[model samples]
Target: MAENYYQTLGVDRHASAEEIKKSYRKLARKYHPDVSKEADAEEKMQAINVAYDTLNNPEKKAEYDQMLDNPQGFAGFGQGAQGQGGFDGAHFYRQSTGGGEHADFSGFEDLFGRFGAGFGGSGSRRQQQSFQGEDQHAKIEVDLDVAYTGTTQQITLQIPTYNAHGEPEIQRKTLQVKIPKGMKEGQQIRLSGQGQAGINGGKAGDLYIEIQYKEDKRLYVEGADVYTTIDVSPWEAALGGQVEVNTPAGRLQINLPANAKNGQQLRLKGKGIPNSKEAGNLYLIINIVLPTAQNDQQKQAYQQLAQAFNAYNPRA
Candidate 1:
């Protein structure tokens, strides 16, 4: 007995045409003899192709479903009429030969033409007319400064190129790409017609560039917002004064509140990445740095201050 087509394709009997096609494509890519290293890749691919060809066609699928529903009806379909089968040969013969509807054999021709080449028939096969190239993906690292201010970068890529003999070779290509401002990390920048070359006059695929921010010790990004930790002297946090700081936008002066506690965040509105849709805010996280009393005079001064604030216990 032949294997069930639905079981071969790993699909349910009632699976939709689209679902069957999706499964077939996925399996074909995995089992394609050109890329797959499995010893039985060609055999698996042939089975997948046969199953897809049968189930993808509406008429063939209907007939297949009927055979599955009543296996006894098709027991002698390929055998001669003299076989003593349970099904009435006269009725089966009438249904197979008397109908005006012709059996569609288009899929069988294609199946044999495509898979026969694998079985030592490549010399007689014709070339495919057109085929779309595979898509290519790559990651691009950009500094935060470059992301904040749009800049042009010259990038070198190892692109696949076809030679005069139609053989694939890796060629180094240089492109000057414009990095747009406010482009977030993990966002993709697509360059059309920059991927693999098409075959037989087909259009080339696209190249997708994923943006990644270089790690900065001072700055961290979340969406459009930027965050940085600013260190302030203990006296500066206690006295409340203006301090000059360097931000991604530029240099700016920020006022520290009196008695500001450590780990306090100050929001600088509209100072982050500038986007037409929505602008981000910059946050300054304050960290108080205590002075070390290395000298005798400094130690004495600290001792006096400790005595002055003895009543003010932090744990209280």
Candidate 2:
């Protein structure tokens, strides 16, 4: 039986494009074989990639949807698939017939031809070499401040140039990329015609850059919102006062209201890292800190104040 693509990716059929992509990226990073140590990591990664590719791409998603919705063309209803010994031959044949979607099958041809060279067909041998050179991959780390403010970066990528035998030899190149404001981690930026050179005059592939955030101690990002914990003295929490807070844009004065409690949040609108048109907000979490001790003079003053207000007992 064909695996349920939506279920494999843990997304609903009505999921938005952004949600689907976000889920896929998270799963892909977790299961990627190069970084993951699980025994089944590679298989899981491949399955995730396949399922994502099917559902995220509109054409493939439509095809799958149609097949499921109109299984009457074959010998099964939707539920009939499980009870009737899995997918029947008629269903398999219909799926293989492209389901009336015209996709370029040349990639499959090359894949098969390369593995079936023993057949000794001259056509197959040519097809085997028709695949473009391997696509190059690189990850770029950017500062969180830059992600909000948007900045261009000059990055160096070592692209592999292949010899006639397809062995990779690294060639270095520098590219200036405009990182859009409000860029998020795991988001991808593509440079057209910047990937591997195509085979036999075919168009060059594309360069894909995935975004990664450098660790920042002061800020935590969740989607568009930025969070930071601010330390406030007990008096500041008890009596509202204006305090200067640091943001990626710079320091700004924020008001801490009287009676503010720990974990209280103050929102600064349009102060987050700037994207293109609008900016996200910054959330300041209040952390109340108490002074442990004071000098002799300060302690004497505190003792006098305590005697004046002896009726107060916080514990009681």
Q: Which candidate is the best by TM-score?
A: 1
- List ranges where model 1 is wrong by over 4 Å: 1-73, 79-128, 156-174
Tens digits of per-residue lDDT for model 2 on 1-316? 5557787888888999888886775565455444455677656765665566567667767876765676555444234322353333223324544634453443234333443442234653322223343355678998887775678899999887543333346778899998887787788898887877654444666888998888877678877778888888877888898988677657889888999999998898987766666777889988888776568887887788689779989799
- Tens-digit lDDT track of model 1 for 1-316: 4456787788999899878975775465556665556788777877777677668877667766786788687776554322344333233324433353453334445565765555334566543334345568888898877767989899998876553234558868788888899888899889998877665565777888889999988789999999988899988999988998888877889998999999999999988888888789999999899989999999999899899888988887
lDDT computed for candidate 2: 0.67
Candidate 2 error regions (>4 Å): 1-131, 159-161, 276-278, 291-294, 301-316
Error of 1 at 46 (Å): 9.7
Range of the 10 consecutive residues with the lowest summed lDDT in candidate 2: 124-133
Residue pairs clashing, model 1: none
